[model samples]
Target: MISLKSPRNSAQSNVSPPVKLLGSALIALTVFMLLAPLVAVIPLSFSSEKWFTYPMPGFSLRWYESLFASDQWRGAIANSFIVGTAVTIIATPLGTMAALAISRPETKGRNLLLLLFLSPMVVPVVVTALGFYLFFARFGLANSYTGLIIAHTVIAAPFVVITMLAAFSRFDFRLMRAAASLGASKMTAFRIVMMPLILPSLMASAILAFITSFDEVVIAIFIAGPDQRTIPRQMFTGMREEISPTIIAASVVVIAVVFALMATAELLRRRAAAGLKG
Candidate 1:
């Protein structure tokens, strides 16, 4: 090793070991915390015993089989998908428009507008649920699919707005003007130039919003009826009624699906960033 007499080099060399140690510790702690519960759940799901007993009670996939066999579980999953998709369809376009408007250089009161857009995220879910219950009851929408969809959209829209705003902040708006000058119409410029640039961010936002609606329980409970029952709402009721390994199995499946979607979104983001740089 070569010794560096420069003060900056000396300071960096002295700091490196401690920084590495701290980073390693943080990574290890995070991994353990995330994986520990998952491991517990997996074993519980496979346990041959009826109850949640640790130790070696043998293992089987009976809980998973039961989960698949149950019509209520299947219906709940379908309901979640319907709710998630509906919320995505509503939130993505509106959020993207809001993000575009707020990101404009000449936009006035942008901070206030952003606050308004993000208020749903800042406010407690229970508060939103309560407010929606009261409002929808007056409108005779309570316990209807429309009410559930609207409630989920309200909660999910802020996530899309925030994600798109982060993506839009680094964009070059002059590109659209250049496209227009190059014989592209206003719509063509937006379609070809802006859409490609923001596509990954939009996808990420949509996926996040979908997952938010999928896992949401508070608003679902307030607005959803038997016909509109979602996976999270069913899971909450099931959890309150009894503790079953089937619940853990269902949770594992949902977690795995969400993890896969998020992983795909992250990969797309990385590719988008690399393409933008190159």
Candidate 2:
């Protein structure tokens, strides 16, 4: 039989058993801590009892049924998708442009501009939400779908900017010159030579933008009208007005969907990175 162990693996195997056990235990503990609340809520969502309780009397899909069949829940979900998609569409291109501008060697104050672009992620949500409320109210934009979409775009754009910045950092800009020398126009070069190389990162950034918009409730609370309530806003209202297990069911579903999106985004990011290495 061939020896399969690499030097790195053999060195790792030389670590003390106690150290490995301790490391494994810590990781398990951390995972448990992070997942405990979500796991607890999931079971309650499935409880047959109308009220939240431990050791549920039975199992039922009543909450899940309410989530899908009810008009309010269904409307809120539709609104969330609409706003999230709009935010993604607006943020992705704008963010990619911003990243391109900042990545140029001739661009001055790149660090300062990058900081301003990413300020949304560092600022308090309430402060940002309040600012949106005040600014949009002046134009009668608050509580409208347009206002919600704009507010979400502001929040979501930062993630795209961050993702695209990293992508641009790994990108080779000389390809533009190469294409231009081959009788290609700037737009043609970007469309044919540059965009394909950066496409995976673009997709990953778009996914992140959508997820950011979908999960945001603070901006929605301040800017969204009664007719523009998204899932997060609806879930918040449910928690405040009625602690229905339906909210829990909605949350579980949202979590699952977000996790899937995040997983796909990570996969795309890795593929982009692999392409760069290759």
Candidate 3:
């Protein structure tokens, strides 16, 4: 018996070792660049020194303890959760509905509508924050939770819309029609037939929207009053007014939360893909 290798395989095998090593080196460099700041910040959060300095004299949990003990930090954390929850609640449904509508073959001006939905993502945050500040002020929403929620929703909704759009791209509309033929109402059909298929995507979008609102700072600064200060806004103020290890601790907590959310989203995404395949 004679063994023969395909030309394509032979060509690929002929690639130089230096090229593979170069590609690996580039990838490692990119990962290091992205993670270097996080690496620095996490250790600094545990440092005992009042100021942010290298070669720490000791490590202590005082900053983390202070974060929990301080009224300002507690209030900011509460406000962040409140606003993030509000934004997710509002944005998720609206985004899913918009995606469903746009996914329909007969929907008119779909491109225009999609562009409008995604405009917030393209526009500069400072510009959007300034606009929200002026608009909310006139409506007596400024310096209120309502104002922050609305502003965050405006920005966060685009993430949900984009995510749902991708999910809807793979959705089978025929199942929805099948449910309708069985005497199900539109809402009932969606809940029973469509929702299960897209639920993971919806959950992921909500998480992303929540993170967007939670981490948002420019809009929070523009619209949030002292009483409505969010964690990011509070951190900004602390950084400007005074330097403390507490901000470092807060950064570590935030980074941890973000990593957890991202991991959850990735799991949901994998499960969604597996479900679709099955």
Candidate 4:
């Protein structure tokens, strides 16, 4: 009684249950708020309703049927795939060459050259599109598949260049010298000593170029017409005439495909890093 007890150790006291409940409720509310719109679309895509109303009344697969039946959609998908594949095929090697040239040990003004190569990625897509439109219009390239592929390649190549540049930067020059001293031909040295080291980055860069070309829209719009419309272009046009849940379904598919590609790229990168470590 004379000596007062030490102050209560409130610091050791358990957090109030109500406070914990409130925190969890807030977190749940935040997650729902972020995902609600996306979740809402899945049901609406299946909704029997003809309009874009939320909290669908019932469900049907009519939109999926309509999507498959549309010749325009099929044409657009084909066009996008063709353009994307062509862009990847052309861009990857060119980008790798450009990166190698720019990264050469004695290259003067390498930064400026690198910046020039990367300009497409830095510049606004709309500006690039407009410039290409005018340039191609002069050359009668507008609305042609060739022009569309070229335009997309311009944008996609930078991604490949940047990725491969990173790989090139990590290269050890001693390996090249060692191979040469061992009497290997220059081409053989590159193929045997350098190619395997950089192959992962090359693959990753090609995948990125493909994705960039696949999703490109601004340049496509400027160059593509009825004959060359891409999937994104089709989606853009579809918004003008009618709204349907099929768009959501298509978007979900695109997202899934992109997610898979990104996952693969990550795996490749990790493998490359591990190889380097070894």
Best by lDDT, which number? 2
lDDT, residue 105, model 3: 80
lDDT of 3 at 49: 86
Better of 1 and 4 by TM-score: 1
lDDT of 2 by residue, 1-278 (tens): 99999999999989999999999999999999999999888999889999888889999999999999999999999999999999999999998998888889899998888898899999999999999999999999998988889888988988998899898888888889999999999999999988888899999999999999999999998998889988999999999998899999999989988999999999999999888656
What lDDT is reached at residue 224 by model 2? 89
lDDT of 1 by residue, 122-232 (tens): 899899999999999999999888999998898888988988888887778789889978999988998999888888888989998899999898899899998888887
Tens-digit per-residue lDDT, 1-278, candidate 4: 47544445443246688987998999999999987977776667777888888677888888877777889888888898899999999999999989998889688888888998899978999999999999999999999999999999999999999988888888886899999999999999999999999888889899999899888877888999789998888888888788777776666656667778888887887777666556
TM-scores for every candidate against the unseen true structure: 0.91, 0.91, 0.91, 0.84
* Candidate 3 backbone collisions, by pair: none
Q: Looking at candidate 1, what is the lDDT of residue 95?
A: 91
What is the TM-score of candidate 4?
A: 0.84
Itemize residue pairs with steric clashes in candidate 4: none
Give the lDDT of residue 252 in candidate 2.
91
Poorly placed runs, candidate 4 (over 4 Å): 1-37, 40-43
* Candidate 4 minimal-lDDT segment of 10 residues: 4-13
List per-candidate RMSD values in Å: 3.8, 3.7, 3.7, 9.2
